[model samples]
Target chain A: MKIIVCVKRVVDTETRVKVAADGRSIDLGGVQFIMAPYDEMAVEKAIQLRDAAGTGSVTVVTVGPAAATKELRTALAMGADDAVHAVVEARMGPNATAEALKQVIDGREYDLILCGKQATDEDDAAVGPLLAAALGLPCVAFVHGLTVDGRTAIAEREVDGETERLDVDLPAVITAQKGLAEARYPGLKGIMAAKKKPLETVACDATGGKTELRSLELPPARAAMVKIEPTAAGMQSLLTALRNDKKVL
Target chain B: MAKYEAPDFFDLDSLLTEEERMVRDAVRDWVSDRFMPVVEKAYSEGYFPKDLIPELAELGVLGGNLDYADFPRLGPVAYGLVMQELERGDSGLRSFVSVQGALVMFPIWRYGSDEQKARWLPALHSGEAVGCFGLTEPDHGSDPGGMETKAVRDGDGFVLNGAKMWITNGNMAQVAVVWAKLDGVIHGFVVPTDAPGFTVREQRGKHSLRASVTSELIFQDVRLPASAILPGAKGLGGPLSCLNQARYGIAWGVVGAAMAVYDEVRQYGLTRIQFGKPIASFQLYQAKLVESLTEITKAQLMNLRMGRLKEAGGVTPYHVSMAKRNACHHALEIARTGRDMLGANGVAGEYQTMRHMCNLESVKTYEGTHDIHTLILGRQITGLDAFGAA
Candidate 1:
C-alpha cells in the first residue's frame, strides 16, 4: 500500500495577520509559518495506516515555494517515508494547486491519496475533489475514521448534523477531518532520521486558473458590549431596546 | 491554564535547523503536557515524578547525545535544546537528565572498556537502569581531589569504602559511578547500588529543587571486580571532564528557566493592574523586563556559539565556565525579578514564578557555583593559582 499525503504551509493561526500594502494579500514579513493544522491529520493518518499494515510507504507532497520544504520535512519527521515539493514561485488557487499535485502524482503508483479537508488560509474545500476528478479516482471527503483491508477501504465522515459511513475502493482520495487522527510528535530519533530521508523537488508550471482575488481587508472591529443588570426594570429596558432598535426580541 | 510563548526576540529560530526545531518542539510539547501539569504539586510535595521516566526515555532524552547503536545520534546543539526545554518545565527535571546523560553515560562512553559499555550504556539509555555519578563527597564539593574514598586491590577485585554527598538520583539509581583513591591515585569505579554494604539515604527538607531526589551514598567494604575501574580515566581529570560536560548543559538549561520566568512576568505585568493601570505601562517594570530579555538573549548567543565549538571540538573548560556562570547568574536574577513583578501572587506556587525562583537557587549552586566558575575564568586569564590560597 503506497500512500501520498498532501500538505500545505500556512501562517500560524496564532499570528495576527495584517493586510499587505497592495490591498490584495496578506503581509508575509515576520510571519511565522507552520504546517497546516488539518494537513497534520492527513499526514498522521497516512503514517498510521502504513504502520498498521506493517508493509507500506507513506510519502508526503506539498505545493508551494521552495521554502515549503520545511513543512515537508516536518511531515517526514513525523514518519513519512519520503517527500516531494512541487515548487511554485507564486501563490496559486485550489485548481492550479491541484493541477500541480496531479503532475507530481502522475507517474506514482499510489493506492491512496490523503489530504486535509480544507486549507486553513483559503478555507476552500476543493483541492481533494478537484485532484480526484483530474486523476479519475473516487474521493471521500471529510473522513473522520478510516480503515483499510486489501483493496477496499471503509471511512466514517461527518455530514451536516449526521454521521455517514462510506466504502471506497483502492486508489481513492480521502480528505481528513479534525477527528480523523491525533498527530504524533516526532521523536528525537525520527527528527535525526528525517534529515537523511529522500526529499525531491520538482518545478511546477502554473497554468492560470479562473478564480481571481479582488481585494483583501480586515474585518470590522466589534463594538464594545453594553452591560445590563438582571433586575426587572433593567430587563424591561433591554427587551425594549432589542424589540425596537435591534429588532430581535 | 497559562500558555507558553517561547521568547525569540532575536529571531533565534532562524539559527536552528529544521531537525533541531523538531526535537525542540517534541520535548517542549512533552514538558508542557506531562511535566507542567504536575510540577507544582510535585515541588510542593517534595517528590520527583518517577512515573514520567519511561515516557522521557521514550522521547530519547536520556543520554541523548551518546551514539548508541540502538538510537539515532543527535548533535550537541539539538541535545542542548532538549535540556533547555526540560528546564523550562522545571530545573529539577533538567537536572535529572543532565546527571543521567552528561555525568553518568558520558563517562562510561568516554572511559569505559568495550565490555563495560556493552553492559551499561544500553540499559542506561533506555532508563531501565538508573545511574548516578558519585564525585562530590561529604567533605569535597568544589575540590574533588581531596575525596577520601578508597579502593584497594584484593587479588581479583577491589574493596571500596567512601561516601558521596548531594548525589542526584542516588537513592533510585541501580548503578553508581563512584570515584575513589586506588594506590594513592583517584580512580572511577562502577559500583552497583545493591552491592554488599552499600547504603543510600535520601536527604530531607530541601527548600530548593525539592522535586528532585537528593541523597547520600555510602560504600563500606563494597567489592567489585578489577574490570569495574574505568580504564580510560586517571586521577582527578576523569571526573572533572564529566563535570565539564554537565556544566556545558547547565549553561543551556538555565536559559530555559530564565525564559519561562521572563515570559510569565511579562504577561503578568501587562494584565496586572495597579493604580487603575497595568504596571507594564510604568518604566520601573519595563526596566526589569528589558534587563531580563537582554541577559537572556546574550546567554542564548553564548550557548549557541559554545554548542558549535563543542561540536567542532577544541572547547576548553574555561569556555564552558564563562557560559555556565553567566547563564546561571542571569537566570537567578531574572527569576527573582519575575517573582517581584508578580507582587503578592509571586509567593503563590500557582503562579510558577516562585517555584522557578527557588529552583534557580539550586541551579546557581550546583554543577559549579557561580563564584567557582568566575575564579576558573579569572585563573584562565591571570595565570594565577587563586583557588588554593587567596
Candidate 2:
C-alpha cells in the first residue's frame, strides 16, 4: 500500500497569539511553527499502516513556503519514506491549498491519502473533503481508529456520542482525529537520516482561494474569577446574586 | 507557565549547522515532554528515572557520536549540543549520557578488541546493559594516576583488587570500565559487575545531583579472563583521553543548565510583581538578568569554538580543561543567581532554579574540579607545574 499524508505548518499551540498590524492575520514575529497537531496524527497513521504492511512508502506532501520544509523534515523524521514540497509562497485558504495538493497528487500512485481533520490555526476543516471531492474518491472525516485488510479499509469515528464504523474501498482519503495515532518524537538517528531522505521541491501555480479572510480581532477579555464563601449566609447571598444579579440560578 | 525560550541572546543558532540545531531541538522536545514532568519527583525521591533508558537508547544518544554500526557519527558540535540540551533539563540526565557515551562506550570502542566491541557496544547502545567508568577511587580522584586499584597476572587471566568511589551508575551498571595498575603501569580493564568478588554499594543522602545514581564499586581479587583487558590501552593516557571527551561534553552541558536557569528567572522576573510592577523593570533585577545572559552567551561561544576546534583535531586537554572550568563556574553562578532571583519561590519544588543550582554543584566538582582545571591551565600558561612542591 502506498500512502500520501498531507500536513500543515501552523503556530505552536502554546504560542501567545497576537493579531498582526494588518488586522487580517496573526503576528509571526518570534512565533514558533509546528506541524499541525492533528496532522501529526495523520502522518503517524500513515507510517503505521506502511510499517504494518511491511512493503510500502509514506510520502508526505505540504503546500507552503520554503520555510515549511522544517515541518516536512519533522514528518520525514517521524518515518515518512520521502517528501514533496509544493512551494506555494503566499498563505492560501483551504480550497486553494487543497487544489495545490490535488495538483501534486494528480498522477501519484497511492492507495490511500491522509490529512488532519483541520489545521489548528484557521481550523477550517475543509481541505480533506475538498481534496477528496476534487479527486472523486471516498472521504472519511474525523477517523479515530483505522485498519486496512486486503482491498478494504475500515475506519471508526465518533458521531453524536456514538461510534460509527465505515468501510471504504481502496484509494480513499481519511481525515485523522485525536485517537487515530500518537506521533513519535523524532529520534537523533531519524533527525540525521532525514537529512539524506529524498525531498523534491515543485513550484506550484495553484492560487486564488475561493474565500478571503476578513479583518480579525481578539476575543473579549474574560472577567476575573469570583470566590464564594462556604457558610450558610454566604450560600444564601450567592443564591441571591445568582438569581438576581447574575440571573443564572 | 511560559514556554521555555532558550537564551539565544547572541543568536548562537546562527552559528550552528542545520543538523546541529535539529538534533538539539529534538532532544530539547523529548526532555520537555518526557523528562520535565517527572524530574522534580525523581529528584525528591532520589532516583534516576531508569525507565528512560530505552527511550534514550532509542533516540540514539547512547554512543551516538561513535563509529558503531548504525549509530550516527555526529560531529563534535552536534554531540555537544546534545549534551547541552540534556543538561538543560537536568545535569543528571546529561551525566547519564556523558558517562555512557564518552566514559564507558568510548573506551570499549577506542581500545577494546573486536570481540569486546561486538559483545558490549551493541548492548550498551541499546541500553540493555548499563556501564560505568571506574577510575576515581576513594583515594584517587584528581590524581587518578596514583590509583591503588591493582591487577595481578594469574595464569592466563588477572585478579583485580581495589575500590572505586563516587562511581556514577555504579550500582546499576552491568559492566564497568575499570582503570587499574598492572606491572607498575596503568591499563583499562572491562570488568563485569556480576563477576564473583565484585560488589557495589549505593551512596545515599546526596543533597546535590539527587536525581542521579552514585555508588561505590569494590573489586576483591575479582578474576577476569585475559580477554577482559582493553588491548590498545597501555598507560594513563587511555583513561585521560576518555576524561577529555567527557570534559568536552561538560563544557557544552553546563551552558544548557545556565540557559535553563536564565530562562526561568527571566520569565519569573517579567511577571513577578514587586513595588506595584514587574520586578524586571527594576535596575537591580535587570543587572542580574544581564549578567546571567552575558555569561551564558560567552559560554555558548566558547563551547561552540571548543567543539569546532575538537572536530578539527587541534584541541588539547588544556583547552578542554579551560572550557569545562569556565562553563561550570559561570553556570553554577548563574543558577545561584537565578535561585536568589526567585527569592522565596526559589526554594519551592515547583520551580527548577534551585534544582539546577544543586545539580551544578556536582557537575562543577566532577570530571575535574574547578580548581584542578585552573591549575592545569595555569601550568600550561606559565610552563610550571604548581600541582606539587618539594
Candidate 3:
C-alpha cells in the first residue's frame, strides 16, 4: 500500500497569535510552526497502514514555503519514507493548495491518498475533497477508523453521533479525524534517519482562488462575570438582573 | 496557576542541527506530557517511576549513543540533549538514564567481549534488562580506586566479596557492572542481581533524589565465571572512563535542572503579587533572574562546545571535569536563587523550585564532587597534585 499524506505547517495552536502590522495577515515573528494536528493524524495513519502491509512507502506532501520542509521532515521522522514540498511563496487558499498538491503527486503510483479533515489555521475542510475530485478518485471524510484489505478499504466515520461505515475501493482519498491513531513521537533514530531520507521540492505557481482575506482582528474580549449572594433577596435580584439587564431568563 | 514554560533566552535552538532540534523537541514534549504530571507524586512517594522505562526505551533514550544495530546511534550532543530534557523533569530521571547508558551500556560496548556485548546490549537497550554501575562503596565516594570490593581467582571463576553503596537503580537492576579489585588491580565484572550470595537492599529515607532508587549491593563470596569479567577493561582507567562519560552527561543534565528552576521562578515572579504589584517588578528579583539566565547561558555554551569536542574525539577528562564542575555549581546556585525567589512557596513541591533545589544537592556531590573537579582542573593548570596533600 503506497500511501501519500498531505500535511501543512501551521502556527502552533498554543501560540498567542497577534495580527501583523499589515491588517491582512498574522505576525510570523516568534511563532512556532508545527505540523497541523489533524494532518498529524493523517501522517500517523499512513505510516500505520504502510507498516502493517510490511512492504510499502508513506510519502508526506506539503504545500508551503521552504520553511515548511521542517514539518515535512517531522512527518518523515514519524516513519514516512520520503517527503515532497510543493513550494508556494505566498499563502494559498484550499483550492490552490490542493492544486499544488495534485501537481506534486502527479505520476506517483499511490494506492491511497490521506489528508487531515481540516487545517487548524483556516479550518478550511475543502482540500481533501477538492484534491480527490481533481484526481478523479472517491473521497472519504472524517475517517476515525480505517482498515485496508487487498483492493478494498473499510472506514468508520462518526456522523450525527453515530458511526457510519463505508467501503471504498482502491485509489481512494481519506481525510483523517482525531481518533485515527495516537501519533507516535519520532524516536531519536527516526530523527537521524529523517535527515537521510529523500525530500524533493517542486516550485508551485499558485494563482489566487475565489477566497480573499480582507483583514484579521482579535476576537472581542469576554464580558465580565456578575456575582450574586446565596440569600433569597440576592437570588431575586440576580433573577431580575438576568431578566432585565442581560435580557435572559 | 501558570503553565511551566521552558526558557531559551539565547535562541540556542538555532545553534543545533535540524535532527538535534527534533530529538530535543520530542524529549521535551514527552517529559512535559508524561513526566511532569507524575514527578511530584513520585518524588514524594520516594520511588522511581519504573513504569516509564518502556516509554523511555521506545523513545530510544536508553543507551542512545551506543551503536547497537537495533538501537538509535544518536550524536553526543543529541544524547546530551536527552539528558538535559530528562533532567528538566527531575534529576533522578536523568540519573536513571545516565547510569543505564553511560555507566552500564557504554562499558559493555567499549570493554566487554563480543559475546558479552551481544548478550547484554540489546536487552539493556530495549529496557528488558535494567542495569546499574556499582563503583561507589560505603567508604568510597570520590575515590573509587580504594574500593574494597575484591574478586579472587578461583578454579574457573572468581569469588567476589564486597559492598557497594549509593548505587542508582541498585534495587531495580537485573544486572550490574561492578568495579572490583582483582589481584590489587581494579577490574570490571558483570554480575547478575539474582546471583547467589548477592543481596540488594534499598536505601530508604532520602530527601535528595528521592524519586531515584538508591540501594546497597553486597556480594558475599559470589562466584562468577571468567567470561563474566569485562575483557577490555583493567586498572582504574576502565571505571574512570565510564565516569567521564557519565560526568559529561551530568554537565549537560544540570543545565536542564537549572533551566527548570529558572523558568519556574521567572513565571512565579511575573504573577506573584506583593506590595501592590508582581514581585517581578522589584529590582531584587530582576537581578536574581538576570544572574540565573547569565549562568545558564554560559553553561549552555560550554556544554555545546564540549559536546562538539566529544563528537570530534578531542574532548579530554579535564574538559569534562571543568564543564561538570561549572554546570553543577551554577545549577545549585540557580536552584537556590530560584527557591528564594518563590519565597514561602519555595518550600512546596507544587512550585517545583524546591524539588530542583533539593535534587541539585546530590548532583553536586555525585559524579565527582565540585571540589574534586576543582582539584582536577587545579592539577591540570598548576601541574601539582592537590588532591591528597596540603
Please give, for every candidate in the order listed, the TM-score of chain B alone compared with the true chain B.
0.98, 0.99, 0.98
- TM-scores for candidates 1 onward, in order: 0.94, 0.97, 0.97
- Which digits, one per residue and each the tens of the lDDT, describe model 3 over residues B1-390? 354566777888888998898899899989988999999999999999999999999999999998878577999899899999999999999999999999999999999999989999999998999999999999988888889999999999999999999999999999999999999999999999999999999999998999999999999999999899999999999999999999999999999999989988888888889998999999999999999999999999999999999899999999999999999999999999888899898998788878988999999999899999999999999998997634
Best by DockQ: 3
Number of clashing residue pairs, candidate 1: 0
Order the candidate numbers by lDDT, best to worst.
2, 3, 1
Question: For residues B1-390, could you state the per-residue lDDT of candidate 1 as single tens digits?
Answer: 566888888988899987888889889989987899999999999988999998888888999898878675788889889989999999999999999989999999999999989999989888898899899988899888889999999999899998999999988899999999999999989888999999999998999998999999998899899999999999989999999989888999999999999999998888988999999999999999999999999999999899889889978999999999999999999999899999999999889888988999989998889888888888889998679744
User: Measured against the native two-chain assembly using Cα atoms, what DockQ does each of the candidate structures obtain, in the order listed?
Assistant: 0.64, 0.72, 0.76
Better candidate number, 1 or 3, judged by lDDT: 3
* Residue range with the least summed lDDT across 10 consecutive positions in model 2 chain B: B1-10
Q: Interface RMSD for each candidate model?
A: 1.6, 1.1, 1.2
Return the top candidate by lDDT: 2
What does the lDDT read for residue B23 in candidate 2?
Answer: 89
Residue-level error in angstroms, candidate 1, position A141? 1.6
lDDT of 2 at B292: 95
Candidate 3, residue B130: lDDT: 94
Worst 10 residues of 3 chain B by lDDT: B1-10
Model 2, residue A4: C-alpha shift (Å): 0.4
By the DockQ metric, which is better: model 2 or model 3? 3
The lDDT per prediction is 0.90, 0.93, 0.92
lDDT of 2: 0.93
